[model samples]
Target: MSPTIGAIVIPVSDLESAKKVYTALYGEPHTDQPYYVGFNVNGFEVSLNPQGEGGPVAMTDVDDLDATRNALLAAGATEQSAPRTVAPDVRICVLADSDGNPFGLRGK
Candidate 1:
């Protein structure tokens, strides 16, 4: 399956403070949780990840999360996290390239 970037995650050290700033910028978040805050701006999802490092992560949408993750691993990407269900049908996992550039893969 051809995957496309569906979400952008920005790492924040302070969730509450970042929420305030993001609220002011994006108006209101569509998904607000202690771990993550997400805003939909002009059809693009921008999210704040409290557990993220200092770099931004781009989440790509795939048809099969497991297969795509395995492909990435075979292509030299390292696993950062195992697949986990975040929503009812949504599954997500993290990986990093050889240079340690982190990204995510999501499916439903």
Candidate 2:
């Protein structure tokens, strides 16, 4: 199956400032914390991460994280991070394309 974008995480130097701006555009966030703020736009998750560097990274949902990650690596994508569990059953990882643009993969 093909991967689909599930979330877009934007990097911010100042969490509070970014929160204010995003909140104004998308309304109140469903999840608010010091490290991350999340808003549900329709069914998609829009998040702010102070720890995230560079620009926004799009998180794509895949069926098999390991297989897909390996395929991407074989296709010239470099691993920025290994797959790690975020929530109870949710896992995520970061990778950069050949040109060095970062993207994310999220799965169970």
Task: For candidate 1, give the lDDT.
Answer: 0.92
How much lDDT does candidate 2 score?
0.93
TM-score, every prediction: 0.91, 0.94
The Cα local distance difference test for each model comes to 0.92, 0.93
In model 2, the Cα lDDT at residue 48 comes to: 96
The true-structure Cα RMSD of candidate 2 reads 1.1
**True lDDT of residue 32, candidate 1:** 93
**Which candidate achieves the best lDDT against the true structure?**
2
Q: Could you give candidate 1's per-residue lDDT for residues 5-106 as a string of tens digits?
A: 998889999999999999999999999999999999988889999988868889999999998999999999999889999889999999999999899998
